[model samples]
Target chain A: MENKENILEVRNLSINFKTYAGTVQAIRDISFDLKKGETLAIVGESGSGKSVTTRSIMGLNATNADVVDGSIEFDGQDILQLDEKELSKLRGSKIAEIFQDPMTSLDPTMKIGRQVAEPLMIHQGLSKEKAMAKALEMLKLVGITNAEERINDYPYQFSGGMRQRIVIAIALVNYPEILIADEPTTALDVTIQAKILELMKELQTKINTSIIFITHDLGVVAGMADRVAVMYAGKIVEYGTVDEIFYNPKHPYTWGLLGSMPTLDTNEDVLPSIPGTPPDLLDPPAGDAFAARNKYALKIDTIEQPPFFKVSDTHYAATWLLDDRAPKVTPPADIVKRQEHFNKTKQG
Target chain B: MLDKDAPKILEVKNLKQYFNVGRKDEVRAVDDITFNVHEGETFGLVGESGSGKTTTGRAISHLYEPTGGEIIFEGKDVSKLKTKKDEKEFRSDIQTIFQDPYASLNPRMKVKDIIAEGIDINNLAKDKADRDAQVEELLETVGLNKEHANRYPHEFSGGQRQRIGIARALAVKPKFIIADEPISALDVSIQAQVVNLLKDLQKKRKLTYLFIAHDLSMVKYISDRIGVMHYGRMLEIADADELYAHPLHDYTRSLLSAVPVPDPEFERQREIVDYDASVESDGKQRKLVEIAPNHYVRAADDEIQMYKDRLNS
Candidate 1:
C-alpha cells in the first residue's frame, strides 16, 4: 500500500487502435499498480485488454495502436514519454516480456543459445562467449538439465513446455526488475503449465522481481499472482489481492468467471457461460461494459458506468452493485458453493 | 489395456505410432499403449503435448496406421486390414473430431456438404433429400440450426465450427468416435458448452468416444473412465471421479497435485513444486499395476514393494 512499494503504476491508461474500418478503443482508462517483488495478474476473456494493458507498459503494442492518454510510471519515471531508443534500453533490461507462444517468440533459424545471448550482447555489452555461458546458466536456472548441449538446439527441436522454459530463460537472462508474462502457460499442457508456473515462482523468489502476469485463466492467477486485476472490454472491472478477487468476489463479472471455472465443485449438469461475447472495442457500449451480459445488471448499470468502490483495503471493483445506493446483491449461488467446497477441501 | 467382459466398440491394443525423424533416434511417439472403449462409454486419453495422446487418438481413428499393435474397431482388425473394402468398412464405423475446429473444417465446403460428405461416400442416404434431412438432423443434434447448413465453415465462431466438425463426424452414424482434445483450443466458457454438447450427444446417439485431452478437470467432467498418460504410457486409469479422488499412480498423484484449483483459498494453500527431481530420486523406477477394480496405476518401487509384501503375506 506504501508509495515506495509501487514498482509500476498506470494512471487512466487509454489505448486505441487505428484500424482501416474505424478507431478501436482497446484499453479505456485502465489503471493498476504492481508492487515490488509481487505479481499483478490482469485476468479476462479474449479482447479484454488484459494483454494490451501489459503490452503498453513494455511499449509492445501493435503498430496501429495509439496511446491516446495516460502514463505508465515505472520506478517513479513515466515510460510513455521515453523515445524508442531509450525505451529499447529499458525493454529486455529493466523490463522484459514473455509472449504467449514460445515457439514464435524464439528464433527457429538461430541456436537457442545465440537467441538468448543476443539480448545480453546488445544490452550488457557482453562478449558472445560470456553471453553464451550466461545463457546456459540461465537455462540451467530454469531447470533445463542439459542446458550446455540443448543450447545448440533450435526451437523446433524442443518440446512446447521446453520451448516455454527457453522463453522464460531468455526473459530472465537480462535479470529485469519486471518480467511481463502474457499467457505464458496457455500454450502448455496442465502439468507442463504447472512446471512453468513453479519455475517462475521459484525464480521470482530468488530474484525478488516484480512480475506482471497477464492471463485469462483465473485458476493460473490463483496459483501465480499476489494481486489480481479482472479486465473487461478495455477496463479494469475489478482489482484486488488474489484472495479478495477469488474468495470474496464483489463483481458479477468476476463471479461469472469463477462460476465458469470447471472445478470439482462446479455442478456437472449446468455449465454457466457469460451469456454473450465480449463487446466490440470499435464501438464499446456506454455504461458498465458487462451490463448487457450481466444477469444482475441494475437500472443504473445500463445507464452509467460505476467507479470502483472499495471492498477491502486492497480491493475495489467497478460495478454499481458494489455501491451502497445500488441494491445489495449477493454473488452467484455457485460461487458460494465453490467457497464451501474450497472451505471443506482446506479444512480436511 | 483391453478389458475382458464388456463389448469393445474400439480396441486399440499396444498401439505404437513411431515417426521416423532425421538421423539419430526414431521418435517413439505412441509407444506400446492399449485401451478399449466399451459401447456407449467415453474413454478419456489425457497427456501433455509430447505424450502421444493425439497420436493414440489418430491411431484409433486410422488417420495414421499404427506401426505396431491392433486397432480392432467393432470387431475388425483395423491395422491388419490390407484390402480397401475392409478399410472402407472400418472407416465407416470410426470417425474423428480434430483439435483445431477452424483449420480442420474445409473452407470451401458448405456446412451441409461438409456434414453430408461422409454420408455420400458411405451411401447411407437413399437420395439427396434424405442426405439433406440427415445433415439437418446432425446439425440440430450438435446444437446448430438446419438453416445454417448453407453457410461456409469460415462463417462461424470457433465453438460453432467445432459443432460443425462434430456434425461431420456424426453424419456417418459411427458408433465410435475419437475426439482429440476437441475443447482445448476453445474459450473456457465455450469449452463447457462443447463438452456438455459432446456428453449429451453421446447419451442421445448411444455413441462411444475416445476423448483425448490434457485438462484433468474437463476430462473428469465428460469421461466415463479417465486414463492418465505420461511420456508415451498410460500411468493410471480409473472411473472419472475415482481417478480424481484416489489417484494411485505416482505420476497421477503428482498430476492431480499440480492442477491449480480456481479458488484462492485452495490455490494459495497449495504451491506447485517441480516434479522431475522427485521422480528421479534414488534412481527409482515404477511400473503400471492394477490396485483396484477397474483401476490401474504406475507405482514407485517402495509402493510396489509394500503391495508385493501384502500380496505374499
Candidate 2:
C-alpha cells in the first residue's frame, strides 16, 4: 500500500468563515494524503469540517471562506493558488464531486442526457453526437436500466436512487483522477444505498480513481474506505487504516462514535453516547476541543492541545491518554469486544 | 421488555388512507393494515422511504381522517368521538414528535411558549406563574435548563431541538406518543443521545410509544415489538429479536439484509437480498397469519407451510 503514489496531499489546511457574529474556524490544521486508486473516508458529525476539507480539494469553498494557511497539492500543483479559470478546467476532467442530495444536485429544468453529456462536451470538446453517445454508455455503466430511453427524461422522472445514479454517471463520465463523494448515499434508502455502494466500488475498480468519501455513517465507512480519518470539532483527531480505526481506536471521541451505534446483534440496554454537544466554533476552545465531553480526560487535556502520537506506521491519534504519563483507561465494552475479535482473527 | 399478558393500548383494524380516491392518479398511502400496541411497550414501525410508516403514525394521531376501517383506543373507537370535549380528551391523550425539528418547531415562539402550548390549551396550569413553573419543570425533565426557555428554537442545536420537541409532547402528559423518524434528522453522535433520552423518559413516565424509523438497528434496540411495512402494506410483525433472527417474509428478509453492520468483516461479506414484488401480484389474496406463537407474516395459504418449514429447519 505504501508503494502506491500519493495522488493528493493536504498539509496543515485551516479554513475560517467570516460571519456576522464572528469568524468561525471551521477547519483546523488537518493533514492527510490519498493514495492512487485507494479510498480515504473522512468520517465526522455535522460541523466537524469533513465536508469543508473535501470541498477545499475541489476549490469549491464559499466566497466568505478564508483559507488561513496550508497547501492542497494535486499532482505537485497547489490547488489553493489556482485561478477560477484554471480550477474550472481541472474540475470535471481531473476532479469531480458528488453531493449528498440528488434531488437538488441536478438541474431540474435540464434533461438527463444533456446534463450528463454537457460535462463531456465542455471538458473534452466532444461533438454533440459523440458526447450523447458517451453519456448513454456512462448511464449504462452506472446500472441505469434502459439508458437509451431514459436519457431523454427530466430529473423528476427518475426516483431518488436513479437520480443518484445519474449523478454518479456525471461524475465518472470524464474518468476523473480523484472523485470526492460527500454523503453520496445518505439521502437514499438502505436497500438503495446498498446498490449505490456496490456501484461505487465497481466503478472505482474500472476507472482506478482515487476517492475521498465523506460521511457520518460508520457502517458505510467500514465497507467503502481503505483508510479512515475520524474528525471531531473541526480537527482530524485520529487517522489510520480502516481496521485500526474500527478495531483498535485510540481517541476517546472515536470510541464514543463507535459505541454509540447499535449493530444488528447489539443487545445492550443503553447506548454509550457522548454526553454533550460539540464546542462553539465561533469561540474556539484554547486546548483540546473534545476534553469537555471526554470521560477519561486528563488535566493537561483541558489546558493544552495534545500532539499526534504514532501508534503504528499507518496509525496516529491526538489524545493526552496516549501520553506516557497519562493513566491507562479502558474503552467501552463494545469496543473491547471488537478488539478481542480483532486479536483472535490476527492470531488464528 | 414486553409482557405476554399486557393489555392492548391502541388497536387498528383494516385502517386505510388513500389519496385521490376514485381518480386516475389515486394512490394508497396505507392499505388495510391491522396491528395492536401492547401497554407499556415500544412498538417500532420500520421501512424504506414511501413505505407509509409515517402515514400510519399520522393516522393513529388523527392527523388524517381514515378512508376506511377502525381505530380503537383504550376500548373506545376513535372515529366515534364526535363531541368537542371528547375530541379534546382524545387529542390530549395522544401526541406526536415530528421528524424535522427545524420545521416541526415554531421559530418565532419562545421555548417556554412552545413547551407550554399543550399545558395552556388543556388548562392544566392555574395562572401565568404556574404555567411558567410547569414550563421550567418540563425543560428540566428533557435535560434543558430554565434559562433555555427564554431562547428561540434557532438558538438550539439539532439534538437540543429534538429534546424540546419531546418536552412539548410530554407537556400534555399523554399516554401514548408517536415519534415519526425522530432521530433521522439528527447527526450520528446526537442520535444516540436522543434515543437514550427517549428510553429514559419512557421508563420514568410509564409511557407507551409508536416509534417509527428507517434505521433497523436502532429500531431493534429501542423497540420491544417490530413491524415491517412496504408499499403501504404491513409485511411482517414479531418480537424485535425474533424479527432480526428469523424474518419470515421475503421483503422482511431483504430489508434486514440491507442494513450495514459496523464490523468491516461482516460488511465485506454482506449480501443484499433483492425483493421481487411480482411474487405478490400473482392474484392470490393474502393476509397476516401467525407462523409462530406470536410472530405474524402477510402471506397466502400456500406460502404459510413453506414459511413454517423454513422456521423449523
Best by TM-score: 2
Q: Write the per-residue lDDT of candidate 1 for residues A158-221, one digit (tens) a residue.
A: 8888999989888888889999999899888777888889889999989888999888787889
Model 2: how far residue A141 lies from native, Å: 0.7
- Candidates in order, TM-scores: namely 0.89, 0.99
Q: What DockQ does candidate 1 score?
A: 0.51
Shift in Å, residue A128, candidate 1: 4.4
Kindly list the per-residue Cα lDDT of model 2 for residues A150-267, writing each as its tens digit.
9999999999999999999999999999999999999999999999999999999999999999998899999999999999888999999999999999999999999999998878
Candidate 2 ranges beyond 4 A from true positions: none
Stretches of candidate 1 exceeding 4 Å from the true structure: A1-4, A127-133, A146-157, A265-267, A325-330, A338-348, B1-6, B19-24, B80-89, B124-134, B271-289, B298-313
lDDT of 1 by residue, B1-313 (tens): 2233668777667778888845478888876777767888888887777888887877777778678888887677876788887788778778899899989988999999999998888889999899889998888888889999999988788888999999999888788888988987877767867887887787788888888887777777777898877777777778888777776655676778878778666775775444562553455566557777777766775786664454344
